[model samples]
Target: MPAIISHDTGTDAAESLVYTSQPPVYTYTTSLISYALPPSQFVTPETPQVAVGAFIFTPPGTSPPKVLLLRRAATDSYPNLWEVPGGGADPEDTTLLDAVAREALEESGLVAATIVEFLGTVEFGTSRGNWCIKYNFLVDVEEGEVTTNPAEHSDGRWFDLEEVRTLAVTTELMRESLVKAFERVEELRRSRGISDPVS
Candidate 1:
């Protein structure tokens, strides 16, 4: 597991560090409190489904970088809300990376060209008395047009980072995770010398 740090305020040599394939690593404290997940209402009923989300970003150049977001269909669980490409794990998936790859492709029709960064997992309790661990990752996608499944999402588009924070989110769970993902993505942008007009 990678160490999760709050940010890079500790390093003045951050520029050199960011050029590498991996981001700066830091450690975090964990609680010893014993907690068990109730029967899940999602992928399974006995354990939290190990899900994954892919935060796809365009390269930093000619234009400001953009991240993809998809709007859920009005009939889906979190209807008419924006989120990155992701979904629950299935029986066919052998590992978390496979699940992430499959989910990203299924949800947004984008294939992973390379795994850029691991944004860590966010654990949250579900209304059904169960908890879920969502593993988020940043990846470069293969060149292709994004095609959203009409049954899954109403529409899909790439949005600027600033605009993403202001949109209506489907769940408080994802809203918090999204914020953290944005921070990591921004850090990546800065490391690559991408100019940000937001600040």
Candidate 2:
């Protein structure tokens, strides 16, 4: 049986991984879909990875700002722990922001209205032997229902400012990320008039 891998969001997206004992074969599909990298590029286990976080914010209206947090399945990293919707930057994504948006929609069915700002970057080494630079982004999502991608998250919900402040997690890092995400959203909302009702 051959293993397969795919990259769907970059300047060079290599979709499908064909693993065999052979020396590897390259095939050009379409004008927009050929990637030069081989299967080796997909085997990045210990490599320091770059990740993008989607801090998808909802308007305050008359209440405090809220952001979506997804708790990954126990089989996944940070199992059963809540974090912003996002994932690592793939070889296909043109930018970190695009990864955030792509991962967010994949994890939770929500589209960002716009990427408001880049909060900052945080470096962390996981227990699973992977180190990553997590790039956090603040995004304004169009008002609508949020649907969770069951494969990724066991639970997903929007946590308001106060709930965010007290959300439980084992690490200070995640706590800080959520707190910071809320702060940034507040600043973005007020400065950009995001919650202002149109007359």
Candidate 3:
């Protein structure tokens, strides 16, 4: 039997994986949907690989702090796997910020009002290739309201860090890294003498 993945926020393991719409066969000129490399191109040992992923957060009358999560659309390679909002970096993207901004707009339809800080980078393997260096960031949304494109995501939700940790759709490494990111955010806030409304 094949491995089943859901990418769903909730725990409902399916017989197949869910993913975003198919990545184009050719890289697009448009920054939003572009690929790291054209499907026909191969990355040689000399070729460097850098990708970006984001942990977008919103403060919604906090009971628990919530971050945006995207459900992977079904696909042959990575059928159903829940992941942070991100994708391959474009050749034209000179900085990680360029890639992060483009991906957030394409995937979540929310623009980063302010780039709070760089969380940290992580190396993760995917079915698509051997390994990728993921650039992670914490973004403040220009407007919290989301306008997601249905073709890319089945559903979108704001999950508290604890709730995210409980989801089976994601990996343990991701949960731990994000929880740490949240802790750092709280620390930064406190150092500035800003208080969490709940406390």
122 Cα displacement, candidate 3 (Å): 1.1
lDDT of 2 by residue, 85-115 (tens): 8777777664444565567667777654444
- For 76-194, candidate 1 gives per-residue lDDT tens digits of 87789998898777665544555666777788877655445567777766546676777787766666778999998989898775676788767766766766766776676576566
lDDT of 2 at 6: 15
TM-score of each: 0.70, 0.68, 0.68
lDDT of 3 by residue, 9-60 (tens): 2222332222222221111122222232342232335334666777776553
Which portions of model 2 miss their true places by more than 4 Å?
1-47, 192-199
Clash number for candidate 1 = 0
Candidate with more favorable, higher TM-score: 1 or 2: 1
List clashing residue pairs in candidate 1.
none
Number of backbone collisions per candidate: 0, 5, 15
In candidate 2, where is summed lDDT lowest over 10 consecutive residues? 2-11
lDDT of 1 at 96: 51
Candidate 1: regions farther than 4 A off: 1-47, 126-129
Among all candidates shown, the one with the greatest TM-score = 1
lDDT of prediction 2:
0.58
